[model samples]
Structure formats: C-alpha cells, structure tokens
Target: MPSTIRRRVPNALLDGSRPTAPSHIDGSATRRMAIVLVTLLGLTHSNPAVAQIEGFTEPHATIDLAATENGVVASILVKEGETVSKGQLLATLDTDVLETTLEVARAQMHSTGKIDAAQADWRSWQSKLDKLRELRTKGHASQTELERAEADCAIAKARLEMAREDQAISALDYKRIEAQLERRRIRSPIDGIVLKVFKDAGEAILPTSPNVLTLVELDPLRARFSVPTPQAASLRPGSSVLVRFPETGRQAIGAVEFVSPVTDAKSGTVPVAVVLPNEHGKYRSGVRCVLEVPPPAGAGGSTSENSANRATAPQKTDGPPGPNRKDNHV
Candidate 1:
C-alpha cells in the first residue's frame, strides 16, 4: 500500500521550469495540478484594461485685448461676461487730441486751392510761351525778350511741380492721422465672451500695461490630454474620442486634431489634442475632463497574418485593363 507524504514546492516549480512529479501521486491528481498551474500562468500574461486619461478643456482662443494707442479711456462699450463679435468696438481712448490732428490733416488734404492754383499758373505760362513764340516769328519781339519769357515759363512749371508735391504730402499726412485716431478705439479681434474689463472710462491705458480687456472664445473648444506611448503610437488624427466632465456630468464628442510626434522622456507618455463643437455657448473652457479612446483593431491578433495580407494585396490599376472584352464583341 502507498502512504501519503507532503513536501515543500521547490523554487524551480514557481519559476516555470517543469519540476519532478511526486512519486506517489496518481495520474488524475497530477493532471488536475497541471491544469491549475496553466490557468495561473495565463493570468500573468494577459493585458490589463487601459486606463482613462485626464484632460482639460480650454477656449479655442484667449486674447488680452490691449490698446494700440496710449491715452485716457474715453468710453467702455462692453462689460465683463458680455458676448461680442469680431470687429465689435469694446473701448475707446481719449480721441480729442487725435481727432483735432486728424481734422487739420483732412483740411490740408482737401485744400484743392493749391493744386488749382498750380494748374492755373501752368496754363498761364503755356499761353505766355506761345505768345512769345508767335511774337518772335512775327519779328515783333527781340530774341533776348523771347528767351526771358521762356525762362519765366520754365520757372512757373517748376513751381507747379513743387505745389503738386506739397499736395501729395498733405494727403499722406491725412491718412496717417486718420489711422492714429482709429487706433485709439479698441475693438474685439475675435467672436468671444468678454471675461474682464480691466480699464474703465477715464482710466489711462498704455500699450505696455496690462490689457484693457480679457476675451475668451467658446466655439469649437479644445481638449488637451496625454496617453501612454504604446497607445499613442497607434492613434491618428481624426480618430473619435469620448470626453466626460466628471464635475458637471457633461459629455461631448471630440475628434483627435493633433498627436505629438515626440514622447516625453521623463513620463513615458505622449501628448494629444482634440477639438469639440461648442456652439450655443454650452461648454465652458478651463474645465477638467476624462477621455476614453478606443483600442486599435486586431489588438491581440496575429501581426504576421496582417503583414502578409498587406504585402500580397492586389494594387489598384490606374485605368481599367484595356476595356471590358465583352464590349469588344459589341
């Protein structure tokens, strides 16, 4: 008769190398033990579920709208939390001095009297030259008198050119002054919600100071996140992502817009960004979010089969091989 005995499992058994079977064990018990060991090994090799990545939502754009020209704020046309469209007037600087300068320039540019005077002088000189030539032809005027008259005509022509140059200079000054005046009035550069009004009426604003207003764009919001290197390698732009805002329980569909080519050496991860529609001002920027990305296709399947199929696949021809032979019969 056989007697039962127990012995300590050797480290070699745990290390996956086959161990010698106990001499007294029956075939049935040994098979059962082997089955249990295989199940444990299978569990160790299986992959874990990918964790959700953390992300943050941000405005499509943020602008600290500043004054292009420095002066006392004349008027504040918008308040914080106000929705404004692109090119909408937001604030104005003191334009009293600038407007006066612009008016002076305009007066100079519109002063046609100088140009008109130049033209009249040119015509008068041309007539006098003609008369001088005619007199010389008739032998009524001396050559010296004719030559002096011609010299006078040439001087008038030069004076006329000088006057025309003055007019052009005045016109350019007018445009420059008008542009300076326009810069005194600040306008929104994008369609967005005014986050803050830094300066109010009667306050001085400088180009070097903090911006006059803070603006944020809400439409087409952006979400920024990072993923593990292995997963990021398989991701492509335009891939769909599911986003969840844990704090608000809000959800939105997003599409991958950017994937960083380089991985972070320290963290062993890669950065990515997605764009989501935020029409109707529903989503707010600067909110924390969670992202769920789908796993790649054939994730656990054979790579060799996929590669073979791709290598042996028939390539598309540029045109139909000769026309259909059936058509030739027709």
Candidate 2:
C-alpha cells in the first residue's frame, strides 16, 4: 500500500473497450445453455399433465338397412322415428308370385298318390315274379315268362324309387320357396330406432337402389376422444372417465371401451372410446363433450400439476367429431 506498483493495461481496456471473451469459453456456455433448454423441453413433453380432452358424442352403431333381394315394396310397417326390436318385420316386398309358388310346391310335396301307386305296382310285380319263379322250378312256366316277370319287378321297383326321389325334390323345392318368401319380408337386424325411411310402399327396389332405412343404437352412447399419446398410455379399458357435455350442461361418468394401439403420427394422438348410458334417451348424440384423463403413474402431485398445465395444454381435435360415420362407431 505504501509502494504503488505500475501495471500494464491493454489498449482496448484503456480506451473503454472491454476485451472480447475467449472463443472456447463462449462455446462452452452456449453448449450448457443448449443442454438446459433440451432438458426442459424433454421434461415438459415426457411427463405432460393432461386434465381434460375434447371429443364428441356419437351413436354406438349406425346401420343402413337394405333389401337382399330386388323387388317392389308392397308394404312399409314402420314409420320414421319408430322404435323396433330385432327380427321385427319392418317392410314387405311384393310376394304374390312367391306365395303362389310356395303353395304349389307344398301341394306337390304333400301329394303321395304317385308314390302309393308306384309302391302298389312294385308289390304286385314282385308277387307275380315270386309266383313265376315257383312255376319255373316246377317246369310249369317258360324261362322267357319268368325273365319277363323279374324284369317287370325291377322296373316297378325303379319307378317306386323315382317317385320317392321326386317327393324329396318337391320337399326341397318347397323349402326353397319358403326361404324366398322370407327374403321378400324385411326385418330389423337390431333393436334400434329408425332414423329415416328411404323407400315407400309400392316403391321398386333394385340392385342399385338406395337403402330402405337408417337405424341407430343410442342406448349406450359412444364418446370418442383423440388424446395425446402420453395421456392415452395411462388409459385402459373399463377405466372410469368423467364426460361433460358442454351444450347440454350435463355430466356423467362413462367407462372406457376402447383405446387404439396405433397413434396418429401426424397429430401425435391416440383414439379412445367411452360408453355413456343413455337408456332414457336423455342425451342426444353428436354433441361436443369433454373427457377427463388421469395422469400417468408416478406423477407426483398430479392435481396441482394438471391445474398448472391446463391453460398451456390446448385441446386437440383430430377432425370434426366423426358423427354419423358408421366406421367411427365403437
């Protein structure tokens, strides 16, 4: 302190210009910052706290009912919006010709006069052949007469067999006609409500015709969600999920029915379906809904984490809810 030591200062420092940092030091600091940013990004994506997912409600099944055979519609038993049960007759095609054919086949099948006559003829010929054999053994009948009797018996037996075969064929024809008549009558394949009727009575149905009706099952409504891959991983079939319909201001608990194993590569999402009870027909399908997804295992304080991340996590929609799409139903 007593003696002042002179120290050399750089020109840049003396001129109020700070010295530049070393290239190595700058590089090291940049690398450390890059690593920290990478780590933070990874943590955010790997353990994301997803609370609610947006989805839509849809029917469990949609069916387009059509006739298997081409014919004119004779009668329509159900109206639009009518509830129907499985195997209930919904409509009938023109069956006048088929009915007549079925009656003719039935009469033919039941007719036993030809068979009875053939059996009588066979018995008479067989008896005659036996008598002829005895007469031939006693040298009372000619060999030609015995041979003719045997041939007649064989012919009669063949005729009887032919009559029986004809009877069997007639029975088969009757059954075939009955099946044709049944096909003309349309029946419901499932217990559901008829959404629409495309055909009317006396309308012609051809191979290229439109469907007869549109049916849907709504008892167990299906709610579908496109969830983030991370959230989907924690979901399993039969897990309870809370579903809220924003339009109706109603909420209900549903059971998870399906979770797709494959992920949508473009959206990084997985498909999930839940079954919501709608036995009373209270909830209509095609409504927007929200689904609550629980956090993955080992996620500490998931409640607070989900709350904190709720605003940052935006709900994703793969597309417009897929309502009324038959292939989209669970």
Candidate 3:
C-alpha cells in the first residue's frame, strides 16, 4: 500500500478569510492596460478617418472681350448669359465713316483707267521709237533725233511704271480700309457664354478702354486641389480620380489634367488639376468638391486575402491551457 500524505491549509483559509490581493505590480499593470484601451476608444470615436481630399471647381477659361480698334459702340448683338459660338458676332462700333471709306477704296481697287491709260501711252511711245529707228536705218533721220526719240520713249515707260505702282498702292489701301471696317465688328473668339456686357450702344471705346464683355467657357470645367507631396507623387496627367460635390451631392469621375512638378514651400503641398466634362452646360463652376484617391496596387488583394484567412481561422478559448498545450516562456 502507498503511504498516505497530508497537506496543511493556510491559517487565513481555515478562518474563512480571503487570501492577500495580487501584488501592486500586477495591479498597476492592469490599470495601465485599461488606460491604453480607453485612450484608443476615445480617439476612434472623436475623430473619424477621412479618405478624400478637398478641392474646388472653376471654369476652364475666362475671357475679357475687347475691341482691337477704338470707336463708338453701334450695336450689341448678344446680351448677358447668352450662349455664343466661336466667331459669332457680338457687337459693332460706329461703321458709317469706315464703310464709306471702304467703298471708296473698293472703287479705286476695281478701276483700271490708270492702267489702261499707261498702256496706251507706252504703246504710242514704242510706235514712235520704232519709226525713228526705221528712219535712222534708212539714213532719213539724224543720230541726234533718234537719240532724242529714244529718251522720250524711256520717259514714257517710266511714267507707265509709276502709274502701275500708284494703282497697286490704291489696291493695298482698299484692303487696309476693309480690314479696319471689319475690326469695328466685334466677334466671339471662343465657344462660351457672355457673362457681362460692359459697353452699350453709343458708348465710346478708346485705346485704353476696359473690356467690352466677359465670356466664360462652362464645358469641361476644371477642378483644382492642393494635395500633400507624398500623395501627389501618385498622380499624373490623364489619371482618373473620383470627384464629389458636397453642396449638390453630385459625383463625377474626372481625369487628371495637370500636376505641379514643384512642391509649394509654404504649404508643403502640390497643385493638381482635373477636368470634368459638362457638355450640356449642366454644371456651374466655382463650387467646392472632394477628391477620392485610390489605394496602391496590390493593396486590395492583400486585404481581401487577410479577411478570408481570419474567417477560416480557428477560434481560441478563454480558459486555461490543456495538458497537451505547450506554453511559450518569454
């Protein structure tokens, strides 16, 4: 038979008293753990993570329309907020004087009287010279006479050339006046809408006058953003981005049009521009927006794989380790 062995219980246990509490080191460690967990929870609740960057929308182009020449405004063709096509007539200056001048120039350019008269004169001189040559050859005219006739013919030829030059100058002057007349008619240089009309009919336009009107292109609006340098590195021309308008709750996919190569020293950011198509004139510019950046390559695959592994993993129990379990001694 095996010998019977006996173990003595503590005095506190025999008296029904609780054992001494855990050491201060263990208690302090537990408090520290609780503090860390509370801090993490508070941070998570107070500040939510933001995945998008803020930006603003602006027109692709804004033009101040003005006349190249000075005159009085005769007519305003388009009013404010009117859509205009490229090369459409917008306004006109006083053209009464210019029109009359252009008409006179046209007549001068079309007339051939001077040219015909010069030709006739040249022919008459040539005929006389021919006769003089013939007379000299037959010994019927003196050498001096022949020489004098030759000089006269040359003078007539010079006059004819001068007349031709005068006619050409008149033609050029005609074209110049016609161009001046056309300049008086202001035309749209771009497909856009007139935002303002600064001049009205009968208003005098001087060389230093302000713009006659303001035009802005609404189609293909531009979105501008200031992004951190680290994030800007991933952007390039033609890259796609998700843009959102918070005010209207509208979203669009825009293509990156520009990315500044140099970082801003003061802001520690880089300027970025994206293009959003508004072909139907549905979108207005100067609105606030947000830009969503895409994750790096292969990040989505890794995250999905991790989630699947977690789902298939075995669950752990909170109880003590079993007899077969091996504890790791750190």
Candidate 4:
C-alpha cells in the first residue's frame, strides 16, 4: 500500500526545514505536500463563475418631469403606467394667470389705433399738399402761409410713420406673451410611459420643488446595470441582451445600448445599458431583475463561447456605436 501522511503540523522552521526531521516523514517531503494543497485551493477560485467577473441588473435611468414654471397644478394629464408620446401634454399649470396676462396683451394690441389709421392720414395729407403747392405757386396764396402748410404736412407724415412702427412693436410683444403662456401647459419631451404623477389638481407646484410627473421611454425602454471592471471591458455597445424578472414574469430581449467608458472607483464597477421594446406598456422601471448580455465578438480572441447556448457566466453585450445611444443596459 502507498504510504499516506495526511495532516502534519509545521515543525520548528516554517519552510519545513525542521531542526530535526520527523521520525516517519522527511522535512523536505512535508513542505511539498503543503504546496500541493495550496495549489488546489487557488485553482478553485480561478474558475470564471467562481470569481474575476460579474454583471448586475438595474434601471437604465429615471427621468423626472419637473415643473418649469410656478403655478397651481391644474391637472395630471397622465396616470401611472400610461403610455405617452413625445410632445404630448402631460400636465397643466393653472394658466389662468398666464392666460389673463395674454388677454391683457391682446387688448393692448387692439387699443393701439396708430397703425390702423396711419397710412390713410398720410395719403390724405399728401393730396392736400399737392393742391396747396399748385395754388400757392400760381400766386393764389402768400409765400409765408405756403411754407407753414408744407411744414405741417411733413410733420403729419412723420407722426403717422412713427405711430405705425410703434404698433408693429406692440404686436410682436403680444405674440411673445402668448408663447410664454403656452409654456404653462406642460408637455412631454419623449415617447414614454408616465411612471408617476407628482401633483394633483389644485396643488401649488413650484419650479424649485419636485416636478409634477415622472416618465420613462416605453417603446424602447432602457434596462440599466453595472459590471466589474474586467467584465465591462469585454462588453461593447449593440451586443444582444436578454432580461428576466422572475417575480414579475417579464422577459425582454434587446441589445447592449451603452457601456460607460470608465469605471467608478467608489462602486468598483462600470455602468451598462440595454434598450428593450415595450410597445404594450407592460414593463416598468425600478424592478429587480437579471440582464443577460452577450459577450463581444473577437473579445477574448473569439473563443468557443459564441456557440455555447449555456455560458459559464452572463453573455457579454456589444454597445451601440451610434452617438444617440439611449439603450445601454446599465
């Protein structure tokens, strides 16, 4: 039978160069066994699933629809989980005041009669001057009186021109006021679902306070998460991604939309993102889940992982190359 020496305690010297050799095992022989044991432990942790790589699942981003101006929130036009379109009305500020101001501006424009009658008076004065000059030069009127009439006609023409210009300026001012008033009716900037309505009707929503609503893209929803540095480097935008939420029973397939260029030292990770199509408005933000991102091609020198349906770890994702990358799976 082969001799078995299982657990031998270290002797006087740590390198196993004992002051005296053990009666059964030599000092050199004891050290070699210890080295072999340590090697086995090291190999276990080096496996891909055991350590050295991982990715996390999280929301891509949360967009707050803030109040741009202060006013009583007239109404929340969208309910929770309601799908909305870009530029669709999402909330309304009590624009009663803004509307009133706009009306005043309109009224002011209407009251300015300067432009309405200005050209008519100028033509009338020109006709009178023509008749007067013809008669005066024919010796029908005094030279001093003709000069006075000419000067009067010129002044009238100048006053009419000045009045018309002022009226044009007022009209422009009223149009600007109307545009400002339109701002009070809040609108959505993206085609997304209304995640929340922060205010109810008759609530005083302020510009500095939290916004009146929260929205996130729906058709092309984003799923965000983080990954360790080593794993992140292998990921590139536009790689295929698979997502699942067992609790919600939501499984979405998309592509890697974004990967942060740098890692965050504090978190010891880099952000990754994916964009999933949610035309039915069934998925939502803030849900815990798993995002399976496919590894990039040619990364790790094009290993056999591409053909393997079951990977040792999460699949790597290719990030989108486009500049408007709204779909990263971070």
Whose lDDT is greatest here?
2
Model 1's alpha-carbon lDDT is 0.65
Candidate 4 lDDT score relative to the true structure? 0.57
**What is candidate 4's TM-score against the reference?**
0.63
Candidate 4, 87-159: lDDT as tens digits: 8988877777667777877777777577557767777777877887898889897787777777877877898
In candidate 3, clashing pairs total 0
Error of 1 at 195 (Å): 1.0
Return whichever of 3 and 4 wins on lDDT: 3
Which scores higher on TM-score, 2 or 3?
Answer: 2
**Tens digits of per-residue lDDT for model 3, 1-330:** 111112222232245443332233244433433332223222222222213568888988899988888888999999999999999999998889878888888888788888788888888988999998998999999999888888988988898898888889988998888888888888998899999999999899987884799999877688888876766776788765556676775555467899999988887878889887665665578877776553333423343332232111011101011221121000
Best-to-worst ranking by lDDT? 2, 3, 1, 4
Model 2 misplaced regions, further than 4 Å:
1-50, 301-330
For each predicted model, how many residue pairs clash, with residues at least 3 apart or on different chains?
A: 0, 0, 0, 27
Q: Higher lDDT: candidate 1 or 4?
A: 1
Per-residue lDDT over 58-172 for candidate 1, one digit per residue giving the tens place of the 0 to 100 score: 9878998888766898899988999999999998888887788888888887788877887888789889889989989999888998888888888888888888898799999
Compared with the true structure, model 2 gives a TM-score of 0.74
Q: What TM-score would every model get versus the actual structure?
A: 0.72, 0.74, 0.73, 0.63
The top-ranked prediction according to TM-score is 2
lDDT of 4 at 36: 27
Q: Candidate 1: where is the Cα deviation over 4 Å?
A: 1-51, 207-210, 300-330
Q: lDDT per prediction? A: 0.65, 0.70, 0.66, 0.57
The count of backbone overlaps in candidate 2 is: 0
